[model samples]
Target: MTAPLSRYERVARKVQADGRVPALSVALHRADREPWAFTVGESGNAAHPLGPETRFRIGSVTKTFTAVLVMQARDEGLIDLDKPVSAYLDVPAHGDATLRRLLSHTAGYQREPYGDVWDTLITPDAAKLVAELDRAERVLPNARRFHYSNLGLAVLGQLVAKVRGGTWEQVLDEYVLTPLGLRATTVTTPRQAAIGYVVDAYSDAARPEPPIELAGVAPAAQLWSTASDMAKWAAFLASPERIDPDGRVLAAATLDEMRWPLTTTDETLWGAGFGLGLILVPEGRRVVHVGHDGAMPGFLAGVYGRRGGEGNPGALGCAVLGSSGGAGQINELVHELLRLAVELDPAEIRPWRIAPPAPTAYRSVLGRWWSEGSEFVFAWHDGRLEARLADAPADRPPAVFAPLPDRPDVLRTVSGRETGELLRLTRDDSGEVVRMHWATYRFRRFQDGFDGGPASAGPEPVPAG
Candidate 1:
C-alpha cells in the first residue's frame, strides 16, 4: 500500500488540471500531524514557483476575520453584539442595525454601498464608505431576511477600528493575524503572490486581472492569504476547542456561538447557511464545514474545517486557492481532499485503557433509572456522569452533567438533549443516590408515572381483586 495521505496529492492534482487555473495551491491541516501542502501550475513569475506560501486574495473570507475581531471585542466588553452601531459610532443612516444582524447578513442592508463602484473600479475609503451610508438603501425591514451587505461589514470594520483605536488592518494584524501566527495573511498583496487571472472560456488563454484595492471595504473583501495560513485559520474556526484550547486567539465557546446557524444560504435547497460571518455548509447531518468561500476578480478560494464527523478532530481543515475560474472547483477540491484524508487515512483509534472511574460521590448516580415512564441509563464515562434514553441510537450523544460549584447535590446538564437544565440528585441516609429529578422530572429505580407513583404499581394493587 502507498500509505495514508499519498492519495490526497493525486486528487488535488486532478482538480488543478481540470480546473485549468494558472495556479492552485492547497493545504491540509490536522491536529495530530504537521500541515501537508502542495501547489500545481505557475505563480505568474518565471523565477518563483507557485508553492504553499504563494498568497491568493481570499476575498469575502476577510469578513470571517473581521467577524472574529468583532467577537473578540465583544468578549473583552468592548462592544455588545445586540447593540446598534449608533450605540457605538455615529453613522449617517442604518446606525440602528445591530452588530449581530450585520454579522449574520440579516440586517436587511443592501448588498453593497451606494454607488456602482465595481463598474467604475473605484472603492471608497473608510470615511467615505460611512459618510455615503445615507445613499445606501435599507431594502427590507430589520432582520427580515438574509441580505448580504458588504457595506455593513465595512461599517463593522470601522467600528472595530474606532473601538480598538486602530485602523482595521492594524487591529486585525495585532488581534488576529499575529496572535494566530498567520504571517502570510495580509491586507496588501505581497511580492511572492500568484497573479490572479480570468481564464478564457473557449480557449487555452488567460488574462491577468488588474490589482484592486478594497480601501474601506477591505474588511469585507480584502485579504491575501497563503493556503498554509488559511488552512490553519479554517481549522481554528472549525475546532477552536482543539486548536486554541487556551483561548488565546479567540475563546472556543465564542467560536461555537459564531457557528450556530443564523439562516440558510439557499432557502429552497437548505444546503448552506450563514453564521456570524461564517458560511456553514453541512456536508451531511454529521459533518459540518464552518468557513467561508472567497472570490475577487481573478482569484477564488475555499477554506474550511470539519466538525462532528469521522476523522482526526485535530486534522479537520483544508484550504484550496486558485488563480482562475469560478470558486466551484476550488471549493469542490477542498471537500474532496477532506473526504480522502478522512477515508483513506483516518485517524488512528485510541485503545481503551483503564483509568480512574467517576468521582466518588457520583458513583451512586450510575446505572439505570426510570423517568417519566421512559427507561434511561446513567453512566460514568470518561470521568463525567451522563444520562441517555435506553432507546437512544448508538450515535446519539448523552446528556452530560457537571457538578454545580455551590450545590453539591445538583448537577447541570451541560450538553446533549436537556441542555441548560438541572439534575437534582436525592440521596438517602447512607449518602447513596437513591433517585433524581432531571429537568424537574422525577427519576426512580423503578419507572415513575407522571402522577408520582411507580409505573408498575398498578391501580393500588387491584383493590377490587
Candidate 2:
C-alpha cells in the first residue's frame, strides 16, 4: 500500500505513549512500496536508536514457523495430516491426536506440557518432554474444540525431528531459517536483542524480566526476530503465491489449505478462527488477516499479513513488537497499521487491458443461463469459464470451471458455488450448445419448468464470442 509514513508514525507514537512501553518497533511491507519501519521509545544508547532490526522474543508466533515446517514435511511425503502423530512419534500420551488437530489447536491437549512451566520458567528439553508425556492430560476429547496448546506443538516439533532424524532447532534452521534468509530469527539470543520488561501496575517503573530457555517447547515459542524480518515472514504467510513462487518451503496450494479456517477462536463473537497453523481474522469483505499473536513474560508481538485483494490492498504485511509484556496495545497496533494501509492507500488500480479470447468450445456456453429458477451469468474471465447467480453478492466468487481432458463438453467446478460438481454441455447438430446440466441440475437459455412446461421466456442470449 502507498499509505503515508507520517500516518503510521503517528499511530506508532500514540501506541507507545498509551502502553508506556520501553520500546516499540513496527514495520510494513508491500511489493510495490519500499519497506517502511518505525521505532520509538528508549534505545539505551544515543548513538544507536532501537530499530526494526532489534530482536524481540515472539513467543507463540513461533508456532506459525513450526506449522510451516510440518507442512513442508507433508509436502515431502514424510507426514500425513490425517494420521495420528503417534504414527510418526511414539509419545506416551495423546498418541491418537492427529497432526491436523495439533496444528489447528483442536487436539484437546492441555495448555502446557503437564507442568507449571510458565510460573517456574523451567521448560523441559526434547527428551524430558517425551519422557513425561504420560503426565500431560487430555483436557478435552480429540477434536473437541479450539484449545490453544503449546504442548501439542512441542510434540509436533519432536515429530519433525523424529521423521527428519535431527533436532527440531536444527531441522528448522536447515529447512526454514536458512532457506528464507531469516538469519535474524533464531533460538539463540542475538546481541541486538531488546530486553523485555514488566511495567508496574500502579507506577511507571518497568522491571526487566528474566530470559529463560525454552529448550523442549521452543518450537512453540522460542524464536526472536525484528519487525522487519517478521514482516517478510508474515508476507510469506499471507501471500505465498507471490513471495515463495518456487515453493521451496510450501506450495501455494498448501498455503491455501493452511488459510482455510477450521475452528473459531472466539466462541461467542465468532470474530476469529484458527487455520492449520495460522490465525484467521476477518477484516472486511473479501479481506481476512492471516497470522498469529504472541506474548511471553516480558515481550509481546503481533505479526500478520493480508493477501492482495486483486490489487486493492496488494500483498501487505505488518509486524509490531513491544518490549513490555501483557500489553494488548502491541497487537492492536499491528492490526491498525494494516487497516490504515488498506484504507488510506491501497495499490494504484491498473488500467483495464484486453488479451486472449475465450475458447471456441466455451464461447457458445458463455452468456446467460437459467437453472433452478435462478438466472446465472456465464463468461470467460481471467482465462477460466465462470458463472454466478444474478443476485450473488459482489464479494462472493463465481463458480469457475475447467474442462475435463478429452471430454470437450464436460467441465469441473474447481471453486465457488457447487464446487467439485460437473457442468455438462449438450450440443445440437449445428455444433451450438443447446442446454447444460450442472451438479445434475438442468440449465437452459430459456426458463423452463421441471415438469416439461415453459415457465416464462427470459432475455435472449448474447451472440457467442
- List, in order, the clash count of every candidate structure: 4, 1
Tens-digit per-residue lDDT, 211-231, candidate 2: 898999998999999898898
TM-scores of all candidate predictions against the true structure: 0.95, 0.94
Residue 177, model 1: lDDT of 91
Clashes, model 2: 1
Evaluate residue 106 in candidate 2 and report its C-alpha lDDT on the 0 to 100 scale.
96
Could you tell me the TM-score of candidate 1?
0.95
Residues forming the 10-long window of minimal summed lDDT in candidate 1 = 456-465
**Cα shift from native, residue 305, model 1 (Å):** 0.3
Quantify all predictions' global Cα lDDT against the true fold.
Answer: 0.87, 0.88
Model 2 residue 442 lDDT?
93
Candidate 1 segments whose C-alpha is farther than 4 A from its true place: 1-3, 459-465
Question: How well is each residue in 287-334 modelled by candidate 1, as lDDT tens digits?
Answer: 788898888988999999888766555638899999984536887888
- Residue 85: error of model 2 in Å? 1.3
In candidate 2, which residue pairs clash?
A: 308-315
